[model samples]
Target: MSLSARLEHHLQASGLPFEILTHRYAATALENALMAHVPGDHLAKSVLIHKEDGPMLAVLPANHQLDLSRLQSMIHHPIGLAPESELEDLFDDCSPGAAPPVGAAYDLDTIVDNSLSGLDKVWFEAGDHRTLIEMKGRDFDKLMQDAEHGSICVH
Candidate 1:
């Protein structure tokens, strides 16, 4: 699928302009960036973390790694990466490793890295390995206005 039904609904409802770019099959965030000809720092990748309350989505640049210690301290809860088995249930509409960063669309809490702020634009997976959604930085900010923001990644 080009996009998750939930994500498509959310995107349209936001009234924000977004472009869907297709690329060769990619298995990882970095691969997605390279295949799409987008800078790794400008491609947002989402990691699902198992938290005390429930699952949380952490968004950061494709080139960075999630700082678990920093994230736990910020959220005040112990967290671990959700296993591959759990992803399908949480993101039933997405490909095995391609989870979109818009947690709100999936009914989950999200925390975005501050590093993405002030960027000119950003790209992210669109529920599949071969399609990417692109949007302006300001539009991204507006879309994620309700999500928490902090430093949660390391090079």
Candidate 2:
């Protein structure tokens, strides 16, 4: 199944209202925001981190950069970026660089940057290079309820 398909299933099962925005293929989260004509700050990007114990997802706005020091402090362990090969194997249903920020879809722990807390709406990859999933901020919060929230990024 493709990323969009899996997302659709998950959203439908959860009964959340959302819209799927399609755009030209993009290889990066910032490019996806540009192609979708959404504010970069409202586009959430997922960065997979490999810790000694396992993997976790770090989600932040497309315009922000992950604050590794802050994350390391919060996680209390050193974390490194997961290689593309690892992502490919872990997110087999999605494109190489298009995994959704909602890590629950792939059964991984998730941590979201507090910077995204107040956006009225948020956009993120739909598991492919050409699709975006848009949802209300409340819905985003609900979707990520199980994920930890912290100051994990720097503007």
Candidate 3:
């Protein structure tokens, strides 16, 4: 089985019910809308930010942008986008455009949007452009226990 298949298998084995969506390479926001078949606001976007010490994963709504200041205060650090060159070395499973919320692959901490707590389910990349995973937001939060919940939105 391929890496993508393995990922899906792992999620299944973990008892996380999810739906996989395939697309012809759309932007993260666009991809989420396409997958949910709804407005962009209905989708959650996971943004991977790297700090001086390590990486921090930030999950936000597709319709909103990340508020770095709020994130910094919450995580207690100045976070920024991982350098293009550093991304591949640190996150081997991360493709050019697909950065999943799973931080185990990179040994980084994760922070999810507080708004996600209200949603029954959410969508995120499945390590590739052609695949997206949709699962219960609460289940995802439980799975990612180490992830901190905060305001990742730009307001």
Candidate 4:
């Protein structure tokens, strides 16, 4: 099955209500803002980071960037963006620039920005740039229990 199909199955199995949004091309935050007619902050950004110890996934509001230093402290390791070429090996069944927020396929821990707590629901890549998945913040939290919650603000 395709990666998006697997992700759909996973969501169904988890009993989470979600909506899938598709775009003509890469559905980046900028594209999503235009498509959904919402500000960039409403879109969630999922980034894959590699640390000296291991790999981790960070989910933050599109309006903010990940604070590597803070993330390193939170995960207790020196963390940096995973090399673009290594994304496939890092996330099975997912291609480069198409990682999901759940991070289940990567078998890596995830950290979510505390700012997400204010949003009732958020949107994230559904294993592909052309697709997106929207779910409640609480549901997202439940699905990614290994995810750490913190202030990922760059300031």
Error of 4 at 114 (Å): 0.7
Best by TM-score: 1
Q: What lDDT tens digits, residue by residue, belong to model 2 across residues 34-112?
A: 9999999999999999999999999999999998889999999989999989888888888788889988888889999
Question: 1-155, model 3: which lDDT tens digit per residue?
Answer: 11354455557667867777666666566665675474555466667788888777777777788888888887777778877666556546556656666664445677878776656777777777666777776777666666678877863
lDDT of 2: 0.89
Clashing pairs in 4: none
List the lowest-lDDT window of 10 residues for candidate 2: 1-10
What would the TM-score be for candidate 3 when compared with the true structure? 0.81
Question: Model 3 Cα RMSD, Å?
Answer: 2.8
Candidate with the greatest lDDT versus the true structure: 1
**Better candidate number, 2 or 3, judged by lDDT:** 2
**Residue 40 shift from truth in candidate 4, angstroms:** 2.1
Q: Candidate 1: minimum summed lDDT over ten consecutive residues — where?
A: 82-91
Tens digits of lDDT, candidate 4, 1-155: 12455566678888878887776555455565466554567577778788777777888776677888887777677778888766667655654567676766456777888787656777777776567777786777677666688988662
Give the per-residue lDDT digits (tens) of candidate 1, residues 85-143.
87789999998889999999999999999998788999999999999999999999898
User: Model 1, which residues run further than 4 Å from truth?
Assistant: none
